[model samples]
Structure formats: C-alpha cells, structure tokens
Target: MNTKFGCCLIIGSFVPQTEGKDMETDKVKQLQAGLQLLEENGYDFAELTVQFLTQLSEEEFQQAKKIIQQSSLNIPVCNSFIPPQLKVVGPTVSIIELDDYLDLAMRRVREIGGEQIIFGSGGARTIPVGFSKKQGYEQIKQFLCRCESYAVKYGITIAIEPLNKLESNIINTVEEAISLAEEVNLPHIKVLADSYHMDLENESFTILKRAIKDEWLSHVHISDRERRFPGEVEGKEAMNFSKLFLILQEANYRGLISSECNAASLVDENALSLQFVKRTWSTVEGGIANVKPD
Candidate 1:
C-alpha cells in the first residue's frame, strides 16, 4: 500500500495555540507557508478546512481555487467540511440554507482537486439542548445525504468523522460512523478514523481492524492524546502508532493519513514532529516486512 501522509492546515499552525485569539491568514499565503514547511518536513500533501471555501464569495472562491491549484503541494483532502457557525441538527438549523452551502462547497472543492472532504465540524453537528436523540440522529442523516447529493455531482467523497463526546454528541466511534454510513447508503459517504478521538473514547484498534476489513475506512487523522503531532509526546502518554500502522499495512490500506494536530510551536521543531511521524511509520512498515505471508 502506498500510504501517503498529510497535515491539516486549519488546525496546524506556525504560531502556538492560544485562547481568544484566532490566527487569520489569507488562503494563498497560508498555503504557501504551510506547504513549504510540510514539504521540507517530508509530508506528501496538505489539508485545508472547507471553511476557507465557505468564507469566500463566488469570485473569491474562484481565486482561492486558483491559489490552491498553484500551490507547490497538493491539497488532497479538505477537512471540516461544514460551515463553521452553522448547525445541522437543532431547532435553529435551516436545512435548505445548509443544503445550498453544501452544493457550493462541493463545486469549489471539486475544482480544487480535493478528493475527500472530512465532515468533522463538532460545533456544526452537536445537537443543541431540547433536541431529542432521535431527532438529532435523523437530522444528521438527512444532512449527510444532502451533502452526498452535492458530492455525487462534484465527484467527491464525504468522510464522516466521529468526534469524541466532548466535541460531538453523535457518531463518536468507528462503529457509529459505519452505522451512519450504512444507514445513509450513499456511495459517496464513508468513514474516517481519527486517533485522538478514538483514544479519548477509549476505543480500540480492534474497531479499526473491523473498519479496514469492511472497507469502511476512507481516511485517517492521527494525533497524540493531547491533539499534538503523533510521536511527539513520549513515555506514558505516547501515541501507539506501531499497532495501528501494522493493522493498516496488513490490510494493505491505501489512503491518506493526515496530521490533524498542533505543535508546541511551528518553528524549527515542527520538522522534527513531522519526521517523528515518518520514522514511526517507517519502523512499523519494517516490522510488517519481517512477517511471513500467511
């Protein structure tokens, strides 16, 4: 399997994470800066949030797509597909409005060569108070199907990302994501296994094995327990990519595994974090090479 790697541009930053302060850079400059750092650090592609497309108008989106096309590296997958401030499962949700937004987003994402769009906007999907669980589930299903309509037209797949409970009330596990995809029964709908969310939920690699066997896994998001880059935190808190990579390699998985995490700072040490991820993967791949074919 040609297991490629990428990092999320929206969540990853050159500046340290801080509260009450959002770092805003134009998409062109952001892509230029991130692609340079990631390419130097041995990354294969860059991931951007669909928020960048949603934030722009028709003309602006065209220009943004141009910028992405001109980037030194490919933006293969765009995460955070939903509009940031829009809710999909609440009394306040306007499904019609959201549907329109999804259509526009899919068109732009298709133009920009993003094959997969990650649906992991915790803020957008969280069921608000007073909404029963049943209502929330039905609403989310409908919302995803609507997105799939656009996806089919624009030639893209939607990877349903299961966030931890703190971030999302629905679809918090690989099983749940699979169930949702099965229920929706859309060819363009798929599942993503995010390591941080899986760890927070106390879910096991066993589920990932199941997902792989069923071919439900479309993409992967890897990070340490604290949402820092994988392999950065060592000792007791280390992210065990060894077993996960073995599962992926044994299954012959060929999909994008992205670093949707933050670094302490994106200075010189950022390259080290990216290298740590590559080295860990290389070690696991080496182990796989020693295993005799059954």
Candidate 2:
C-alpha cells in the first residue's frame, strides 16, 4: 500500500440511510466495533455522515466523540451534507433554515476534527421540473459560495462531488464540478472524484488527471461496480483501479479515499477491501505516480 494515500473506513451502520431502522444499543456497539476493526486492520481514518452526526443532541455528540477518540482513528471527511427534505434550489426553499442547518453540521464536523465535507446530496441539490437548468446552475453556485463562508469559519473545505445523472440532474460530472469550483473561486471550496460515479457516468480517468494536476481533487470514494468492496466483486469482471490510483499518485494527490460501498461483513470486508485497494494502489509505485514536482 502506498503510504501517501489514505483510506476512509465507512461502516454501514454509521451511515444515515440506516440510522432510523436500527436500535440505539445495536447502532452504538456496531459503530465502535467497526472503528476498532478499521484500526486493527491498518486504516488511519474514517468518513461519517455530517447530517446524521449533527442530528445528535449536545450530550450525544460528546458521547459519540468519546467513542471515536477512544477508537484512535481520525475522521477527516464527512458525507451526506444535506438531508433529502431541504429544497436547496427551488422557490419553495427556506434558505435561512438551510444555512443554519449547514452551519450546525459544519460546527459538529469541526468539533470532530473533520477537514473536508462531501457535497453529494442528490435530492437536496436536484433541479425541480419546469425550472430552467441555467437557473438551477446559478443557484448551486450561490449555494456553494454560502457554504464556503461557513466552511471557512470552521477551517473546513466543501468538496463539490459530481453525482451521476441518475442520482442528480445537475453537476453530473467532475468536469462540471471543477467548473463550479472555479466559479465559486473560494479557497474553502474544492472538488472530489468518486470512482463509482465516474463509472456510472462513463467518465474516463483522463478527465480526473486534470483535477489532480490542478490540485482540485480534495477527496475520493472508491467502490466496485456493484457498489461492493473492491476485491469482493465476484467473477472476472472488476473495475480497473490501477490507472485511477496511478493518476492520483502522478498528480501527487494526498487525499482521503473512503470506502462508500455495501459491506455485508463489516469487519472481514473492510480488511479485504483495504488489502485489495492497497495492492492496486501499489502497482505504480516509484513511477509517474510517485513523481515530485521540481
């Protein structure tokens, strides 16, 4: 495994999509155990859902923070920035409440030592029917600009994630996200490249190379085609991560690569996925992936 690259262990139980169904007792234990598993298997950091983490009351936040600190793994990145009900762009939206919500989320993230937040909330950012795409684009730019303000206060960066078209109608590619980042033009705003979305969008790594060279790539999420742990993909069909890893290394990208996949066996799959990712990330060591700028 390349020491420069970092992996973010994203356990299923900690994710927001599953937050409501499970019992409180089971949830806490699973979260702690998953963190322990990641640390025991060589992962340095993990990603948490900002929305869910911020939903905790003050006391819960303190207790949760204690468990995380005790686990010895850092949380440098956060996912699920906005909740589904927040209409971020339409006329029926409540901008003030949304801003407050985002600020609260960032505050919680700052408290937990999170350095980056993923803006991949497909439902929140979606353009409503009958609205012009151009209008939606402008609104997104303004939204990100406001997000940058809050992010700056917490010493955090908002990583613009390009969701695939199926999940989002606007900003569906890294190229578009880069354009938005440039438009926002704030140091606290950046971009991310998720391999799963890239595959779904048919985005070639050639485009990602540009993000790396320009230093716009802030974080990454790696999952197999079926959204499973990389090596856990059965049969001969598997995504070729070697080129992507090489591109990231060649660009000298020192960002977090969180596993945002479905893990049937959290402990076992986390280790297996890490090992597979490490091997793939190692294929181009000392080559272009390891080049240093003069």
Clashing residue pairs in all predictions, respectively, total 0, 0
Instruction: Encode model 2's per-residue lDDT on 141-233: one tens digit a residue.
Output: 888888888988999999999999898999989999999888888898999998999999999878878888887988888888878778888
Report every candidate's CA lDDT.
0.79, 0.79
Model 1 over residues 214-253: C-alpha lDDT tens digits?
A: 8889999998877877756888779788888878877878
Per-residue lDDT, model 1, residue 69, is 73
Q: What TM-score do all the candidates reach, one by one?
A: 0.90, 0.90
Clashes of 2: 0
Residue pairs clashing in model 2 are none
